[model samples]
Target chain A: MKLKSTAALIGSIIGASLLAATPAHAQNVKIGLLSGITGPIAAMAPPMIAASQLAVAHVNEQGGIGKGGKLEVVVGDSACNPQNATDAATKAVNIDRAVGIVGPACSGAVLAAANSVAVPAGALLITASGTSPQITSINDKDLVFRTVPSDDYQGRALARTLKGRDITKVAVAFLNNDYGKGLAEAFKAEFESLGGTIAGYSGHEGSKASYRSDLAELAKGGADTLVIFDYGDGTGLTILRQALENNFFKTFIGADGMKSDAVIRELGADNLGTFFTSSPVGEASSSLESFNKAFTAAGQSPDAIFTTTSYDAAFLMALAIEKAGGDNAKLAESLRAVSSAPGEPIMAGEWAKAKKLIAEGKDIDYKGAAGDHEFDKNGDVPGTYAFFKVSGGTYESLGEMK
Target chain B: MELIGLANYAIFMGILIGIYALLALGLNIQWGLTGLFNAGIAGFFAVGAYASAIITSPHVAGRVGGFELPIVVGWMGAIVFAGLIAWPIGKVCLRFRSDYLAIATIGVAEIIRLVIKSEDWLTGSSRGITGIPRPFGELDYVASQLAYLGLVIAAVAVVYFLLERQLKSPWGRMMRAIRDNEAAAAAMGKQIEARRLQAFIFGAAVMGLAGALFVHFNRSITPEAIDPMIATFLIWIMLILGGSGNNRGAILGAIVIWLLWSVSEMITDRLPTDVALQAKYIRIFVVGLALQLVLRFRPEGILPEEQARQTAR
Candidate 1:
């Protein structure tokens, strides 16, 4: 009679603990998302997070991963800082037991988090927007991967695109961080290798106000062409605005930082004609055009921004998880098998279609909402860069580097 | 209670308690013994941190012999530099009331961060100073981390001993007299400015030593690594809670607060999914609430120091 009572008590305890739960979060496969929701980079990050949320909703609607399992993404705000990012990473890794991590938009935050913790613990950590060369170079771990190509490759592509143009010598301005330095060094190396001259390479802190004082120095450059390897808008946006106010330089060439609508909106179309190079996003590819229409139909805009990249990042991770049979440890191994390769068919912004291919055991390639989601051994795609020119008050692609 | 390796657990407790003990003692010298309130402990910590970082960063140009320096020299240089920075800042702001001093010191701390972030020549900016070789290169990474933690504790013991000895000396007597009544000490012709300056500088130097120790133990340092919240308020909380102006109190405060914080965090982390989201914020709230209650109930602290007590006994 005592043993019967004890068994009943144990059964009740298990039922109360598991069955009394009111939420679906317990059974869900959790993914961690860290973002700069309210920091200096929030303008670039907020929509990316929103887009990632949309992707998660869409994935869950299709019965989530592993047929019956749920998919839920937990988020942490980094405020674009190292300590804050580490704290977020720790919470996600230690507490959430996230199978994968999706963001931390800037290189500064990513640098503090990428290795040491998640990769060693068998979690797949991927970055959507951060493009510093060091992010990939500092690792031999397969768990650490990125969707965007490093600025090193982008810098090289920008130099090559300008090689046949009228520009002979170029002055460069860079933000003072890994993204800026690596890009500046690569651009200089690529340009000089092809007999081009660098008038000057100057750097400034990213989040600062007023660049006029500094821009005044670089404005009277001997080189007519100016390559800006710096973030255009932030605390430091004041600098570029001040330079434009003073009419410092006319022929402006920019890195991915300049590709944002926020930058164009700040500088205006009258300041267009000056070109900036960035990823081939929202370029109206047949595949991408269809994606934009569907994304808009689903109440999301498939724009060429961090949002699109983050969305694709989420989708790819889910696909990788499915391909690896829902094992987080094996998801990273399947990534190389799925990355964009020449001659392999590209799966662009169509996961529903890729789902069929994933089942058929075909060499499935993924083209994301951002662009062709290819990755080098270093976990970067090094894809074609679109040379955008501002014409008639909007940025239009003049050509692209493939 | 039945967890294996009781020996390892004791060692862990011993090392963490010791390292934090040094941190508290260093702050004790500044705020406890000397009456100079600095909310910028993190700045000096960062300074000593970057100094060793600048000397040792493999990515940095013109490194000493292209390798990290001997850990002893690195730690010593860091401590001395920490003190040197503090001495001047104290001289400039020490004349003001506690709140004003805090404001100025906080501003100084912000400036330290801005400089570290902008000046890539010194601190490596956003990429941060990485690949800092371990103190004992022969040990593996985890072992090295734990071993370095042990070294910091041992270092704190030496500091604690010296501090205990100094507290019994004439210098310490003068410090207390000034702390009790600055004007009275001045009237007694105790060279008030010189005495305060000496203590401030010495305390800052010790704070810097803690910073260097932290970097080597972690094998990394970032401008953001030494946060004001941790370096500034954590010290204040520990010192106040443990009973300020007492060595034993300071050590006890560090261990107690850190233990509660870690354990509470672990518990909150394992909570059910929906509540897990709120658990972190709840944990912070609990810590804050407990501290408030402690202050209200035991304003004199759990182990209050006897005022105007005999010198050594």
Candidate 2:
């Protein structure tokens, strides 16, 4: 009894001290910048984080949220692991008091954060890169939104891209995750529906040392092309190398995750001749051009998958916060107002003008750098596709997927 | 206002520590008492998680188990399934030395990971099973978090009590004897292999229970829920640092290590973006260094194993 009482007393003191430690800072509206900074896709984090920071910096320079109140971003590393992502989301929302989150990056991490943290905490989360169709049905009450189109759109685009090349038969090897599974399933369905036969399909676990067996089996299906859905930094390289060693595959079709300089460097430009990749493209707009310029001017690459989308995610969340007058309860509703149509058009880097329009109590359509977003009730964006093929040691845009 | 948030964070941390404590206790039973190094705690944990998830989640197209049974039933299924899986593995590996068991257990874990990843119909095909009904999950945010904390605390207390009782029993003494001196204990008519197998399966069942607790708390389970090596090593360190034979030590080590890891992360998170980017590696280095320091100085652990008064010889 004595020990228990002592524990209770200590706990109360700790709680009281914790409560006292936080003095209110109403001038800064905290936003969470979350991404997988230390896992399979860690390579993708530096630029994405920079993009978010650039958005915040740009917002601050544009007279901030409202009446000189700044937007402060708290960075959280999701690590691309579900549990870690959940924990990171919780900390960013609860401890750091972030009113909104700009990312959780990967579909799996975003899913974990959305269901486990964002929804429960009532914090608005705008994922910059999550493209899994599974995210389309996460039950987040519109709190979870993404700048990228789901794989449902990417799959159709991939099907069309492959068919245009007269490649009708394909074997598929996908990393086991929401992004991989959703893209693979969507691609298979669209490809089959388009009269192309799926020669084989294998969903392999990621981070494995090798995928020789699965690749060999996929090879035996007699498909001329191997369509792989996986992040370039993880098992995708190993799988391709193993298949090459076994002479299992040469021709390749890949999704957005494979549109990386790392994949080209690792697989060699010589071997990429027969390779083609399709990813969601931002509609060509002056906003996109400016964002690309600003991003590169900050000494970061703007060409990586999702870099522009991440910048737009941060920019949109800040706009929402500003429009809501820093009230988190109204932030979600304000997000829809800012990103959807039926408003005065506002381009990226026009935060000062957007602030003026919001002050006039007029709805402003944020034509973001990534695209013109008109969020559905489920917070999904309309998708456009960019087809690219390896050329001159890098991926050169072939054409739009239409 | 910030105090409430901190309290909620504490509760979340407490809940995770409690679940990890269950795993640590399981490891204590296996390695601390029986001299068996079951390196596949993550595998057994996954079995429990996937089993419970399969049992309790709402039915989806192309997947098994729309039963949507009560959470208790799911937990029971988790324990039973994890125990049964461990039973076969233990039967095959308990006859060998600990190194062989380690290798076999890791293999089992890898295989289990593959099954969870590849078997889409069974485990929801990498999107994983979601919408798991969390008890008291419907309550308001603070209330819900508190209720879950209460549930986790209760589970840990029950596990701790039962295991403590089991530890002081005759079977516990016999198991310790076998662990300390296998030849002498074998000569004394204690069927060592069978007993080891029993402990192994029982420990794995506990780990499965931990998985159930975790899945229910998150209200979802994915193939990537647990980092196999990092989680397994953390639990191993907890058991080693807290003193293997002591139940209290196991729980203590869990809470301490988890707190340290998370607290360090929170501190590093406050750094500037550029500095914080490099802080994650520093956090890992600190954890690694702490473990080494603990091993070098207090190899027997914070609370060293209490030596039994009676000698088998």
The DockQ leader among the candidates is 2
Worst ten in a row by lDDT for model 1 chain B: B1-10
lDDT of each: 0.69, 0.85
Best by TM-score: 2
Fnat for each model: 0.14, 0.47
TM-score of each: 0.79, 0.93
Per-residue C-alpha lDDT of model 1 across residues B1-313, encoded as one tens digit per residue:
1111233333444554565667778878878888778788778878887776556656546223244567777777788778888877888877776889889989888888778776656676656676665576345424543565568677887888899898878888789999889999999999888888888788878878777766664455655465576567777778778877788788888888766644564576466644654454554466577679779998655566655344435
Return the interface RMSD of the candidates, in order shown, one decimal each: 7.3, 2.9
Report how large a share of the reference interface contacts model 1 reproduces: 0.14
Per-residue lDDT for A1-402 in model 1, tens only? 999999999788667755543334335677888886645566676567766766676667765766566677777755565545655665566556577888877776676566434543467878887776657654436777777777777888888878867577888888766677778878899999989988877887665556766677776667766677766556334655665567676677777776656666776777665555555563327656655665677675455367677877887777787678655668887877776554245444455556566767777766666677767777776656778776765567767774
Lowest lDDT block of 10, candidate 1 chain A: A17-26
Q: If chain B of candidate 1 is superposed on the true chain B, what is its TM-score?
A: 0.90
C-alpha displacement of A85 in model 2, angstroms? 2.1
Model 2: how far is A115 from its true place, Å?
A: 2.4
What DockQ do you compute for every candidate structure?
0.20, 0.52
Q: Which CAPRI quality tier does the interface of model 1 achieve?
A: incorrect
Rounded to one decimal, what is candidate 2's iRMSD? 2.9
Clash numbers, per candidate: 5, 0
